[model samples]
Target: MIDVYLLSGFLGSGKTSLLSHIIEQFKKEGTKPAVIMNELGKLPFDSRAVEADVPLKEMLEGCICCTGSEKMEAQLQMLLEGESFDVLLIETTGAAHPVEAMDAVYSPLFASKLNMKGIITVADCKRWLDRDKMTPQTRMLFLEQIRHAHLIVANKIDLLTDSEIATVTMQLQALNAKAPIIQTSNSKLPLNIMKKIEATFHEKEINETAIGKQLFLSSRLHTFQEPVNQEDFECWLKELPDTVYRMKGYVPLVGHKNPLLFQYAYGMVQWLPEMIKMPPQIVIIGDQVDRIDVLGRISND
Candidate 1:
């Protein structure tokens, strides 16, 4: 059985850094590990930062817990058929629900071949303490990520004092009393923690109840045939409908010789200097997003 490890955490919570360290450890032991990185947007930044020598898979434009679950299963099937690896590491998007992602792994297609080792959640101490600053929906997602973790890594402890760390630990314990919490800096935890016996994947009644009440999240990929007006695009993005939670893609700006990578989340837009020659396409994810309205606003026409 191919051992599967699901790493869940919020955006900027140090999931990527922890994943890199895990990959290195596996390599040092002479075991090949496959990586699957999920992103809310189509433009994948973290996947590229992982070690190039290791096999990697990108699940983009949606979270595996909801919209990307089917695609995730299909990708896993492909990977199992095409490659030979000792373990599979799935790094879910910050917005993902671990229950949903774990449910996907227990599907009949992978029931026999894949063994879920456990869910390791990495949380930034400061971020966890400041979750009230986020929107209700965003905050719910953040909390839910920790709800089902087998182990909780309270990372960035160096950012807190003894008193603050105590408070953070208490908060995490309140949220999840069962999972053992490991306080660490730089997202590092004892290697033995990862080697623990695989957690039992019980088919809880709540899983069935939640399946019907799952949120509606969909993605739309918009392709631009001509270069887009940078200034106009910025204005449009700033005024995007609240339904659009995340937007990212490659865009050929009017003046730029190469296409630029654009990322938008929680009302913030960032244009990375990284350039690519691929066709201009942007993926937008949200609930009930109107593609026609999005096309009208984003198109330079």
Candidate 2:
């Protein structure tokens, strides 16, 4: 049976960074790691972070929970049939509810071929400190992500002051007393820390109170026709409502030949230069987003 680990975390909480670390560790140990990356839009951005040689499958256009269970079963079957790997990692979308994601993976058709290693959740330390700013639904989503993990990674601690880090640690411990919490910058997990997660005999634990499909979130995709002035684009970002949780993709900026990878989460934004040309498009995800209005604004300028 292939070992299966479900990587769960809130939007922009360093799930992808942890994924890279896990892949590297498995490679060093001579174990092949296969990945199933889920995205809420037609164009996938995070999957690009995975190496080219690893076996990977992308589930786009919906959350694993929102997408039909049969769809997940089919993807698992395809991977099982086509790949030769020791471990499989399923990276759920940021908007996904943990209970719903867990339910999707426990399909009876493929359950026996897989060993359900516990959930590994990455929590953003600064996000937890400022979670009060999030919508009620989003706050609950963040809580649920931590509640169900077997291993909790408190990421981005470097940004927090000593007092803030202490507060965040206490809060996470209160929320999840059962899981081991590790603090790290950039979601770096030591090889031994993974062993602590692996040593956990994870049985399928589904919290009945989990807010499954009730969390209403939506995503919109917009492609840019012309390079955008950085100053003007950032000014528009201020106009977006706080309900807009995540926005990530490649953007063609003035004076740059290649598109820069842009990510925005909870009032924070980042841009990374890209060496090769990429499609200039962005996917915006949020709770009850004004898609019509937001899309119109994005399409213009």
Candidate 3:
């Protein structure tokens, strides 16, 4: 399976810069890379960073997550049918939500053909520190982008004062307790970022087995055999830990004839009405979650 990496960050947070660096590194290691870049404008700019030799597919006019899932799936199919590459990189628009972008990539049609490496979020240190100046929606988006990352690149540290750096680092750590953060300037990264990330994951795997902790970025699927009380489910959601980054599936709520499509990210929960019958299961993604305990609580409810 081809390894897939999703690049996420707010506008001017150095996502394109990081994408360029990653592609260059892959080229040095004799690995061919393909890119699927999303832009929220009519014209594409980040597409220039992708080299001519690298197979490229651009999604312009909207964020991939906001765009129809069918479009995203079709683009992936086209790339797979036409290109040969060791790795695929998706650069999302600044306005995109990391969890939603991931949902788009998890299309069942191409799921078996790819191995999800993880989301690598590039955050501008100064921008992160001043995120409150942004509109409420934008600020929430910024936080969510950082919160759901598998690996974070705290970029543009050159512009931040020493004290500001500490403040931002502390906040980033608080938001994402497990993802490794690499401080950089100009979106520059260490030559072994991938190796370091892999090593970190391996260590987490060992720790998981030794201490009975959930694996970092691990996912669990739970299928409900019967409909659950809506009030009970909402209460359970409120009690979920912040480590539960994302969850999505169909849920059969009491009093409803059909299961509702549910999506949760960060602290927000969305339940969309579904007309057709769907599987009653949820895919929970998080770090160090107590799977047995979590399932038990929901099952008892």
Candidate 4:
């Protein structure tokens, strides 16, 4: 399986800058890394962010968790099936929730296609403190991104002082105690720290993931289970709120021997015949999603 890393942060949090450093470090080590950038608007900002020579793909015209989720799956498949690489990195939009965007990889279409590493969220130590004053939507989205990530990269520390940096670290630590937080300036960090990241799905924490937190797994687990009503499943998916940026799951249909596949783009729903060997598990990564209720509905349906 391929190792996929999701990079997210608020506006000007220096996600692209940090990602650029990662790619450069890999090149220095003679490793090739593939990158995917999600453009929420028509302009491809991330495409121009890189200075080094590297193979990259950009998904434009939508947020990775919003309009371009399907395209994300397609682009990722193309890279793994058509191209060759050692690692997969995704740089999410400043406005999009990173967790929801990362959830796009949860399909059976990508189960064997690639392996996902922990999420990397870059927090601008200086900007994060005043985020509440800049805008509420951004504040909410940034908080959501921080909650779901397995690694918190407290970047842009150059602009902050000793006390300010300490405050931000304490706040993030209070919010999430499990994930380790790293300090960086313009993405300048040790490669060994990132290489140490395990690319496996940890179900206990993932199943308990909040809708806003992006899903970061630590293992590869697949299963098969009983049938569910296709109609109710669709309804449930459609009823989800806009904050639900991404949702993915595997379910057996009533009549077919194959599993009835499920993947959602926030409120958008899609189902198809899945021949892959997958379990009854579904992973929902988005903004403000009800994990237990969603799991219960899938099981009852």
Q: Could you say which candidate leads in TM-score?
A: 2
Tens-place lDDT per residue, model 1, 1-301, is 9899999876667788789888888888888999888887667766865887777889876667666768888888888998889999999876677877777666788888988888999987877777777555666767877767888999989988999999999989998887889998888876677878367546333332121144444566778888878888888877776556667677888878877887765456778765548657877766556553765655554
- What does candidate 3's lDDT look like per residue over 1-301, in tens digits? 9888888986667788798998899899899999999865444545767889999988866667655467778889999999898999999876677767867888778878988888888988877776666545456677878887888999989988899999999999998898889999878876477544431233221111101121133446678889887777878888886556556678998878899987665445778888888778776655445453554555433
> What is candidate 1's TM-score against the reference?
0.71
Residue 45 displacement in candidate 3 (angstroms): 1.3
Which candidate number would show the highest lDDT if scored against the true structure?
Answer: 2
Q: In model 4, how large is the Cα lDDT of residue 221?
A: 20
lDDT of 2 by residue, 183-264 (tens): 9998998867766565243444543323245576778888888888787788778888767878999989988999999999
Candidate 3: regions farther than 4 A off: 195-301
Separate clash counts for every candidate: 0, 0, 0, 14
Cα TM-score per model:
0.71, 0.91, 0.65, 0.65
Candidate 2, after superposition: displacement of residue 209 in Å? 8.5
Q: Rank the candidates by lDDT, best first.
A: 2, 1, 3, 4
TM-score quality measure for candidate 3: 0.65
Q: Model 1: residues >4 Å from true position, as ranges?
A: 203-301
Per-model CA lDDT versus the true structure:
0.76, 0.83, 0.74, 0.66
Residue 107 in candidate 2 has what lDDT? Answer: 71
Worst 10 residues of 3 by lDDT: 206-215
